[model samples]
Target: MTERVEVRQNVLKENDRIAGELRRGLAERATLCLNLISSPGAGKTSILEGTLEALGGTPLRVAVLTGDIQTERDADRLKRYGFPALQITTGGTCHLDASMVQRAMASLPSPDLDLLLVENVGNLVCPASYDLGEDAKVVVLSVTEGDDKPLKYPGIFRRARLMLLHKIDLLPHTRFSRDAAVADARRVNPEIEVLETSCVSEPGLGAFVRWIEQRLAEKRQAGRPARD
Candidate 1:
């Protein structure tokens, strides 16, 4: 058990090194990188689809890097919105690490972008352990997934800056308790911001886009040199 723990620590140290490099590069470019994580069928892709569509007419330059175990379907769905979208097939890996993201960044059409959204593999556990040098970690939770997820997967909730409670349109049918979910997430992370969203009915989709825009603006402002 001691040897195994040491090996895991060594691996994480290496990942953190690479992530630090990635973070510096993004900061230099003033890019707001967001790592989005969730369970399968939690509406991560759907939310990205809507976000990309909403930002299409805006002047903000945006790109996406989506990860999956096999198919490139998520990237395909995002590309139609006229933004640069790439797929990182992780083979059988449960999560995307900094090395994979570093390699994927090289293939982007442009190095300069205002927002870089990385849709991590659909797993809350392993993904939370790996840092991809994102400005923030955003977790998506669907009403169909039950309200106990925040309590069950505390690691992700604790680290995430925002939680998008998705599939709100089906709230009338599902046994999901919005109040309970929010309470549990806040219990895990007092600073975690929650947004109720639905890709079908488009409830909080506008607020989601505005949130990204605001983050982008803040990143750019921070990167600007201070006046004497």
Candidate 2:
């Protein structure tokens, strides 16, 4: 057990070192990177689709990189939306690491784009430990997934800067407790910005887009060359 623990620690340390480099590279190019994480069926892809549509023709130039255990389906879906999309099939890996993201970044349209949205492989546990050098980590939770998700997956909830409670259109049909979910998420992360969204009804989609724009603007401003 001790040896396993040490190995895991070493791997994470190396990943963190590489993530730091990736973060600096993104900053140099003034790209705002977002690491979006969630479990399977959490509506991550749907949320991305809606978000891309909302951001379309806006001032922010954005792209997406989606990860999966297998298949290019998600990437293909995003491409239809007319955004530059890349798919990282992790084979058997449960999560994406900094190294994978670094390679994907190279193939992506020049980091000149205002934003890069990374939809991490659909898993809650392993992905939480890997830092992809994103400006903000956003976790998506659908009401159907239950209100206890935050407590069950506190690590991701605690690490995330924002939480999107998706599937608001289905709220009327399900027994999921929106207030309980938000309360639990806040309990774990008091500073987390919570937003409700429904791709079907388009509720809160504008706010999500605005939030991304704000982050991109900040990253661009910070990356600007120091003027005398």
Which candidate tops lDDT?
A: 1
TM-score per model over all chains: 0.95, 0.91
The runs of at least 3 residues in candidate 1 whose Cα sits more than 4 Å from the true structure, single-residue gaps closed, are 1-11, 202-204
**Per-residue lDDT over 1-228 for candidate 1, one digit per residue giving the tens place of the 0 to 100 score:** 355443335558989999999999999999999999999989999999999989999888899999999999999999999999999999999999999999999999998999999999999899999999999999999999999999999999999999999999899999999999999999999999998899989595987888988898899899999999
Q: Write the per-residue lDDT of candidate 2 for residues 21-95, one digit (tens) a residue.
A: 999888888989999999998888988998888778677678899999999999999998778999999999999
User: Where does model 2 exceed 4 Å of error?
Assistant: 1-11, 202-204, 225-228
Candidate 2: clashing residue pairs, number: 0
What is the lDDT, from 0 to 100, of the residue 22 in candidate 2? 92
Report lDDT (CA) for all predictions: 0.95, 0.89
Error of 2 at 155 (Å): 0.5
Lowest lDDT 10-residue stretch of candidate 1: 1-10
